[model samples]
Target: MKASAFMYGLITGSVTAAVTILYSTPQSGSEIRSSIKNASTDMKHKLYDVKGKISDLKDSITHMTKEVKELVPEAVHDIKGSIEQWQLSTEKNKLRLEKEISAIQTSLAELEQTIAAQQK
Candidate 1:
């Protein structure tokens, strides 16, 4: 049973015990019957209130679950797009660096050839 239901049961039991003890001391049959009936009505109302609260809580949970479900896929898609863009930019930078390195290598080889001719 739910915590709320268990707590309500305990409250109801205590109340019933108190009423029974009080009435048992010295009360007419008609008065006892009337008290019992009032207790019954009060119990019914308490039960109804608990049921309504439970229903509201269930609806709130369902709405929150749906919102989370809807947001998760969109969040994942955005992250994936960002990763792809970052990868593309990184590849472009790598290519540019390679070209710069190749140019430097060629210039070093030409300078070596010029030095050799000067030595001759």
Candidate 2:
């Protein structure tokens, strides 16, 4: 049982008990009938209002779910593309750095050979 339904039942039970007590007391029949009619009308209106709110909430949730579904795939695709570009650029930079290091090593070896020849 839903919490709202349980609470409504509790309230209805309490109201029924109260009304029964009032009816048993020395009140006019006309007044008792009028009270019962008013209570019934109020209960019906409250139930209708609750139903309307639940329907609106359901609609709002459905709309939000659809919007999220539409956006998530596009967002994932954009992120994947960005990561691939970054990886490609990093690989290119690594290759360039390696070439620079090799050039520096070759220059050092040539300089060492020139110094040895000069010493001789």
Candidate 3:
């Protein structure tokens, strides 16, 4: 008899608590479930969008790398050619300057000898 009384009290307490909780809730169960579903769907869409942007960024990087690979050798070859042309031009200028310096030295020696002869 004591066990039966204890079970009855437990059942009544459980029902009362459940009723209180259902009545005190703000939104209905369906509304909360729908909101959760919509939020999940929105998250999925955003995830897909981010993945697509990452793929595009990867493709852009790959294309830029290929272009750099092609251009670097060409740029190096052009620079080498320019250096060679500059060396050739400076060689010619060096020869011409040497000739002019020799001519100036010869004129100075002639003037020095003429002055000495006049003094004597």
Candidate 4:
């Protein structure tokens, strides 16, 4: 049972105890029956209230799930695009560095040839 139901039981029990003590006499059958009827009505109303709250909770969860499902594909697509762009940028940098190294090596070879001729 919910906290509210327990609270209701406590409240009803306290009230009944107080009333019976003050009266100091046994209740008639009709009085007992009426009190029971009222208690059942109260409990029934509380149960319905609890049910409504639970239904609202379920609806909230379903809505959140749908929103997440919709967002997942968009997030994946963005990540894939970012990865592809990163790979392309890395390839371009690599090619540029290779060309620069080849040019440097060629300049070094020409400098060495000139030095050898001078020595001879």
Candidate 5:
């Protein structure tokens, strides 16, 4: 008897819940279906647009990497040539400065000798 009572209560509760759901819904079944379909279509278009943008980005990155690989070697070669040229130019100036310093030392020595002779 207790089991039969429990079963009856369950059925009654299920039927009342169904009727409440059917009457309380704001949109009809057809309108809900249409809205869902439109939403799915919009989502697909957005996904395709995102996919195209990613492909374009990948292509641009690949092109830039290729350009950097080509330019790096050329830039390094130019820098090496510039350094060698600078060293060559400075070598001539260094020799001339050394000669000038030696000449100045000799002149000072001769002046000191003349002053000592005059004192004597």
Candidate 6:
């Protein structure tokens, strides 16, 4: 339970006790009546104050949730972009390596042909 709820419980218990005292004794009736209005009004203000604080806390949580929801998708898109760039780079390097290997093979064939001609 919330602290405000607990405070309300305590206040209600006190009011009950005060009423009990008022009925049990004659002098207590005048004293209880004198303070009852003030006590009830004070409790009303505390309740409204607690209610306002709760509303503010709820708004803050909702805002934070929205921010997190917005950020997560953006973060995922950014990671995907990085992965795509890395793949393109890897493909470019692979093609360059394949071209180099093909050229080396052609050079070796030419050298072998020259060696065979010389021997003939």
Listed in order, each prediction's TM-score against the native is: 0.50, 0.56, 0.56, 0.49, 0.57, 0.48
CA lDDT of each prediction against the hidden true structure? 0.94, 0.95, 0.94, 0.93, 0.93, 0.93
Q: Flag regions of model 2 displaced more than 4 Å.
A: 1-20, 23-26, 94-120
List, residue by residue over 13-42, the lDDT tens digit for candidate 4: 999997876477477767877887898999
Q: Give the Å shift of residue 74 in candidate 1.
A: 0.9
Which of the two candidates, 1 or 4, achieves a greater lDDT against the reference? 1
- Candidates 3 and 5 compared: the better one by TM-score is 5
lDDT of 1 by residue, 15-112 (tens): 99988887676877788779889999999999999999999999999999999999999999999999999999899899999999999999999999
Candidate 4 stretches greater than 4 Å from native: 1-26, 93-120
Could you tell me how far off, in angstroms, the CA of residue 41 lies in candidate 2 after the best superposition?
Answer: 1.1
Q: Candidate 5 on 42-102: residue-level lDDT in tens?
A: 9999999999999999999999999999999999999999999999999999899999999
Cα lDDT for residue 5, candidate 4: 98
Better of 1 and 4 by TM-score: 1
Q: Tell me the spans in candidate 5 whose CA falls farther than 4 Å from its real position.
A: 1-25, 98-120
lDDT of 2 by residue, 1-120 (tens): 899999999999999998789868776878877988999999999999999999999999999999999999999999999999999989988999999999999999999999999999
Better of 3 and 6 by lDDT: 3
lDDT of 4: 0.93
TM-score: the better of candidates 2 and 4:
2
* lDDT for each residue of candidate 6 in 1-120, tens digit (9 for 90 to 100): 999999999999999997787778755656767788789899999999999999999999999999999999999999999999999989989999999999999999999999999999
Q: Candidate 3 regions off by >4 Å?
A: 1-25, 98-120
Judge candidate 3 against the unseen true structure and give its global Cα lDDT, from 0 to 1. Answer: 0.94
Q: How accurate is candidate 2 locally (lDDT)?
A: 0.95
| Ranked by TM-score, top first | 5, 3, 2, 1, 4, 6
Candidate 1 has which clashing residue pairs, if any?
none
Candidate 2 Cα RMSD after full superposition onto the native fold (Å): 6.9
